[model samples]
Target: MNTANPQLEGLYLALAAMNRLMVEKQLLTHEEIHETLAETEAAVMKNSALDGQSDSHRKAVAFPIRLLMTANEAAERGGEPTFEDLARQVGRTS
Candidate 1:
């Protein structure tokens, strides 16, 4: 990742580092992160949070989250699909 795109790699690393810092500072814990992810997955799975979001907004948020979730699952099974593969699998393109 750092080899293909330093800027993107830096951003990802920085965000992860910040998240780790929050845990180190006791501002948040992995348990809280897991809970949030579960709650978000529930809401998004049912599209229960579309009350105020426009269709475009929902797709914008949903697509990426869905893509990442799919990737995460695939990773658990020792799969490493490229971003292009993930996009197509998720029925999305940019």
Candidate 2:
């Protein structure tokens, strides 16, 4: 397990708690939570790259960040948030 970043660990913990809470409240099915978590983790990992890049590359990177923000918002609202939802919200459609 990587513990190099406390903030990332904290986010993982918070996401776990959210999953438990959603399950307890019946806001999300167990499978749905599991899938969402997996997708979220992948998205976070992909966006973790911070290589120096051109302005165009940075602009492209913003797409994932925006999708993540939308996903977080939807999760907070107890909505049935999924990777598809995030993609659609960000106009990525994928």
Query: Per-model C-alpha lDDT, please?
Result: 0.56, 0.56
Q: Which 10-residue window in model 2 sums to the lowest lDDT?
A: 1-10
Q: Candidate 1: lDDT of 46?
A: 61
lDDT of 1: 0.56
Best by TM-score: 1
Residue-wise C-alpha lDDT for candidate 2, range 4-36, written one tens digit per residue: 655653554456456657767989766675467
**Per-residue lDDT of 22-66 in model 1, one digit per residue for the tens?**
666888765564466556756765674557766566665566455
lDDT minimum window of 10 residues, candidate 1: 8-17
Q: Once superposed on the true structure, which residue ranges of model 1 sit more than 4 Å away at CA?
A: 1-38, 44-51, 92-94
Q: How many clashes (backbone atoms < 3 Å, residues ≥3 apart in a chain or on different chains) does model 1 have? A: 0
